[model samples]
Every structure is written in structure tokens, then in C-alpha cells.
Target: MSAPNSLKDVYLDEMKDLWSANDQMTRAVKQLGEKVSDPKLKQMLEHSVGGIEKHTGVLKQLIEAAGGQAEPEHCKGMEGLVTEALKHGIKEASSDGKLQDVAIIAQYQRMSHYGLAGFGSAAAYAKVLGMSDAETKLKQAVSEIYKGDEYASKLAEAVEQAAA
Candidate 1:
């Protein structure tokens, strides 16, 4: 994508970037799901895949509404985050089930925090653009991401206790 010449351009770019980010995260979460042993964690990851797909659809719609192509721009930031997540959560994971679950939670939260920032920024841009519908959808995605992050934290605590 070209350099943003206006706030509208920036908004469109952000949506495109998030579209890519959600796609990457969806794949990573699925891969991680296969590696996890905990039933709750597995379920959370499965749900996340669906949520990410839903957010991606909203992003595509927002991009089109902003008069931009619905194609996703490659999100290098998310690429790096996904790389790190896989490396730490799966590649170097502990053999112990509880410890591995903790590592997975840490990686998952890192990616989720990244999503929160991106979605929140896009929502702000949408608000400034007077695109109330886009803003609402983005805000909803952010809220869902927050809920997942919170659940991951709780799961991490439980896994840690089990490890102890």
C-alpha cells in the first residue's frame, strides 16, 4: 500500500492490515490447538478461529465501505508476532503438559494484545471518519479479543496451579 495521504486512507490501510493479521492469527491458533492438551484451552483456540474469521469478514466490509479494495495488505507486525508465538509456544515448549499450556497462554496473550491495539486504533479511525457502523464492528472485535485474553489469563493461572 502507498503512503497514507489522508485519515481515510489510513483507516482503509488499517482495516486491510488487520484482515491479514486475523488470517495469520487464525492459522497460528489452529496449529497451537493441535499441540495443546488441555480441553478448555483447546476449546478456546477453536472458538478463536471462528472469531478471527468473523472479524476478517467485518474488516473486508469496512475496507469496501471506505472505497478500498477488499484485499488484505500483508501485516508484517502480525507475521513477527505469529512467528514468535509458534517458536515459544510450540517449538521450544516444555514436555510437561501444564508448563506447555502456560507457554501457550503467554504466546496467545501476546498476539491478542497486538490485536487489541490494532482493532482499537482502527475503531478510533472509523469514529473520526464518521463511519459509525465500522467503528461499532471494530469495537466489538476488540471486546471479543479482550475476553479471549482474559480467559487465557485465567487458564494460565489454573495451569500454573496444576504444575505446582
Candidate 2:
């Protein structure tokens, strides 16, 4: 894609990046879920997978609404995060199930926070462009991402307590 020359173009670029990020996150979360031993943590990751799918659809709609093709650009940031997550959450914590759960929760939050920032920014851009529908959708996505993040935080507390 060419350099974004307008606000709408920038919004499109952001949507593409977010689409890629969400796709990568969904895959990583599923892999993490498979490795997690705790039932509650596993369930949380499973639920998040659905939300991530819905959010990706929303991003596609928003991209079309903005008059852009819904093709995802490679999200290198998410790629790096996922790499680290797999290395530490799965690879490094193989010997300790509890520690693996803790690592997954931490990595999940890091990814969720990234999603929050992207959705928040996209919503703001939509609002600035006077695209109320896009803004509302993006805001809803942000809320969903936040719920996952909050769940991870609670899970982290539980994991820490278990470790103590």
C-alpha cells in the first residue's frame, strides 16, 4: 500500500494493521489455551477466541466502510509479541504447568493491551472522520478487548496467590 495521504487513508491503514494483529493474536491465544492446564484459564482463553473472531469481522466491515479493501498488512509488533509468548509461555514453562498458566496470562494481557490501544485509536479516528457507526463498532471492540484484559489480570492474581 502507498503512504496514507489523508485521514481516511490513515484509518484504513490502521484497520489493516489491526486486522492482522487480531488474526495473529487469535492463533497465539488458541495455542496458549492448548498448553494451559488450569481449567479456568483455559476457559478464559477459549472465550477470548470467539471475541477475537468477532472483532476481526468488525475490522473488515470498517475497512469496507472506509472505502478500502479489507486486506491485512503484516503486524510485526504482534508477531514479535507472539514469538515471545510462545517462547516463554509454552517453550520455557513446559516443566511447570502452573508457571505456564501464569506465563500465558501475562502474555495474553500484553497482547490484549495492544489491541486496546489499536481499537481506541481507531475509534477516535472514526469519530474524527464523523463515521459514527465505525466509531461505535470500534468502541465495542475496545470494550471486548478490555474485558479479556481484565480477566487476565484477575487470573494473574490467582496464579500469583497459588505460587505463594
Instruction: Give all TM-scores, in the order shown.
Output: 0.98, 0.97
- Mind giving the per-residue lDDT tens digits that candidate 2 earns over 43-131? 99999999999999999988987789869999999999999988889888857788788888999998888899999999999999999
**Candidate 1 per-residue lDDT over residues 71-135, each given as its tens digit:** 99999999999999999889999999888888888888888888899999999999998999989
Number of clashes found in candidate 1: 0
Could you give me the TM-score of model 1 versus the true structure?
Answer: 0.98
How close to the true structure is residue 9 of candidate 1, measured as C-alpha lDDT? 92
Q: Which ten residues in a row have the lowest lDDT in candidate 2?
A: 91-100
Candidate 1 — which residues are off by over 4 angstroms?
Answer: none
lDDT score of residue 144 within candidate 1: 94
